[model samples]
Target: MKPAPFDYHSPRTPEEAVGLLAELGEDAKAIAGGQSLVPMLALRLAVFEHLVDLGRVSGLRGIERRGDAVWVGASTTQTAILRSPDLAAAVPLLTRATPLIGHFQIRNRGTVGGSLAHADPAAEYPAVALALDARLEALSPRGARTLPAAGFFTGMWTTGLAEDEILTGVSFPVRGERSGHAVEEFARRGGDFAIAGAAVAVDLDGAGLIRRCGIALFGVGATPLRASAAEASVLGVKAADVDAAELGATALAEPASVPSDLHASGDYRRHIGAIMVTRAWRRALREALDA
Candidate 1:
């Protein structure tokens, strides 16, 4: 399927990109790596009169460390994050899930900001971002505004981005020395979209008691959700003392409404989500204790 005819503008700067989006308004769409948007355009799922290409935008394609947070440009590809030793050391959870994305070729072109803006509930990046309490930065005709990961996804394939807004980058809080990150997913085959998945990050005190824990689940909800109940269950407990099965059950407290497709039922997803949550919890505990 060929995309509908449209005017393409390759902007050299983010400011120019922003200006283009503002000027074109509702008829314009931003293209980063085109991993997601191109497919939609081909299928006519998305029809735009103008396409603003962000590939030539210079400053939107790198990584930087700012105090306690790591800022990743919206155009930074998944392949880049996977191989970045700096990102791995700064946020291991993201690195752990990078391999779970589409495939080597797709990851080579899929941009981090693009994924977040697309907000696919089952995508690996969204769950990891939620687990890390990342902040999304958007630029719009009205100016810049920062949004918390929790408030970013409003529904399936939806986000808080305004019509004239462009996501510039995302900032993930640095995990401290006592922190640990882990991820796990169940897919029909390698590189397939997960049937269920979980990402966990933990910060422990000197006494080995959990100081903070974040758990995010995917593939069972309209939006990736933080396993608040499960996280609460682990707080103040030593990593070795956590009960994985119990945490899993707690994580399923408010099961996200699942779509019943030919592949799996809502009940099946709930069960798988629970299992993935338990596995991720156990893995995070192991990493936390260096066991």
Candidate 2:
């Protein structure tokens, strides 16, 4: 079925988009790539009386290095991320994860902000954002406010974005020297959504000891989850000696947190999650040590 009949408004600027959302209130939905929302609308899983299109909003589309972090406009497409040399150099994890997203056709039209705002636990971008401590920027009638990645995702297909707020951009910090990042996931097919995945970043000290670590898991929880227990356990330890298998187990230590579905049992998903985490951890460790 087609989406419910709705009035469409194309906004050329972010201010106009925010104003439209504010005025339209509960009935309005802001759309960029529409890769996720359109399918939901088509299935009648979501309905909005008014659609605010941000395709013409130029302000929310670009990539640049601002100070020590990389600022990616909310409208930046996954295709753009794959093609940006600077982004790859500054945040290699993003490029490494891009291929694991849907096929090139979907990536061509899928915006980073759309994926994050939709907040599907199985998506790659959200987990990568979490692993990198990305900061999300939003605009509202109340002005601008930044949300940390840790708190940005609230639940399945939900986020901290208010009804009247529009996500403007995101900031991913560059940890600079001695840092390595890797992404590993299990999927039924090349472009299918991951059944379980892990994005890992490791920072090593001069003596090859772990300085910091970030591990984010997807497809095993309502929202993308950070492997805090595993992260804390490996800190300050010799990077090479940290057992990837044990680290993976620690990441999924809370078996109850993993969800079961027709595709895979919770126990099975947790087991796959552990393997993904282990592979990612080992790759990240190698890169960090070599750096």
Candidate 3:
């Protein structure tokens, strides 16, 4: 199927893009990369009178470190993040998660902002962002504001972005020297969307006690869910004494509100979610110890 006819507008700056959105109101949609939007358009799942292309927007295309955080422009491609050694060092969890997004072809054209805005429950970036406590920046005719990742995702395929706002960038707090990260996911094929996944980061004190930790799970909820119970279970515990896998399983022992789709049952997804968390926790623990 082909997308319905629509007016297209390319904006060279974020201000111009937001201005177009403000003027076009609900009739327009901002597009970057188009990996997700194109498919939705082709299927008529989404229709827009005007399509605002943000590819030419200069403000949304760079990766830089700002103070203790790393700022990634909304338009920055997944491939760009995968190739940046500096970025990997600054935020290892993001680096570990990017490769799991899709195939090389999709990653080449997929943008960070695009994925976040698409808000797929199984998307890797959303889980990483939630785990790392990243901040999403947006611009509108009224003004600009930053949103916490926790609140940015309202539900599956939905976000806090207003009709007249354009996501400008995302900022992730830099990992300390003793911090380590890992991403674990299960998919039927190499490039397929994960059935269940976990993104984790941990910081250990000199004595090998867990000082801080973040755990986020995907493919089993309406939005990427932070495993707050799991994180709290490991705090202040000696890394060597903690059975990461057991703790992970125990944390998610209770049934959760997960979707039951054709690909897998809700019970199966919940089981996989626990396994993913366990694998990611163990890997992250090893990394923290090595660091």
Candidate 4:
């Protein structure tokens, strides 16, 4: 298969990229890593009259700290995130989850913003973003705006980004020394999309009680599912006394929400979702205790 014929524009800056996007309107698509979009193009799943390449957009690539949050340019590669000591120290959940994205080769070419924009339900980045309460920055001809991770993902392979907008970067809050993180996922192979995955971050008080917790599950719903109910159930509880099974059950209380696909049944996905959540929660609790 081959991509449909299209005009290609290589932009040197984000403004230019967005400008091209705005000018092209619904006929154009902005590409960063092209890991996901390229396949879509080849299969004709997505077609456009123009392709706006942002690879040369310098402003859209880097990792830096702003106030209490770390801003990662949309073009930052998964491999870069995996090797960034600053990112690992500031947001360990991201570091823990990056390797599970695909294979080493895939991660080498996959961009953070590309994954977020692609919004794959089984993707590690989306669940990590939701768990960390990250913010996505979008640029358009109308100007710029920030979107909370919670509302950014609207459905499977879908997002709130307007057709004329380009994701420029993402911001993640710095986790303090008292916080711990872990990622748990189940996949058939090393690079396969997760059947069920969970990303967890926990902050502990001096007394070893869970002061705060963030839990996000992927491959279980239309979008990354934040287990607020499960998180609430463990607050003020001793980390050592937390119940994985109970928390897992709480996270998937509505079994109907789990999707049934060729890989697994709804009941099985719900079960796997619970198991992943439990493992992530317990591992995070241990890290918090050790911290």
What TM-score quantifies how close candidate 1 is to the native fold? 0.96
Pairs with steric clashes in candidate 2: none
- Tens-place lDDT per residue, model 1, 1-291, is 999999999989777888999899899998888888999999999999999998888888788999999999999999999999999999889989999998899999999999998888889999999999999998887788999999899998899998778888899998888888889889999988888889999988999999999999998888898988778877898777788887887887667466667778888888888899888888877787872
lDDT for model 4, please: 0.90
* Alpha carbon lDDT of each predicted model: 0.88, 0.92, 0.90, 0.90
Q: Report the lDDT tens digits of candidate 3 across residue range 128-170.
A: 9999999999999989999999989998799999998989999
Best by TM-score: 2
* Per-candidate total of colliding backbone pairs: 0, 0, 0, 0
TM-score of each: 0.96, 0.98, 0.97, 0.97
The alpha-carbon lDDT assigned to residue 129 of candidate 1 equals 91
TM-score ranking from best to worst?
A: 2, 3, 4, 1
lDDT of 4 by residue, 99-121 (tens): 89888888898999999999999
Per-residue CA lDDT of model 2 for 96-182, tens digit only, reads 999898899999999999999999999999999999999999999889999999989999999999998988999998766999999
Better candidate number, 3 or 4, judged by lDDT: 4
TM-score of 4: 0.97
| Model 4 worst lDDT run, 10 consecutive residues | 248-257
Model 3 lDDT-worst window of ten: 247-256
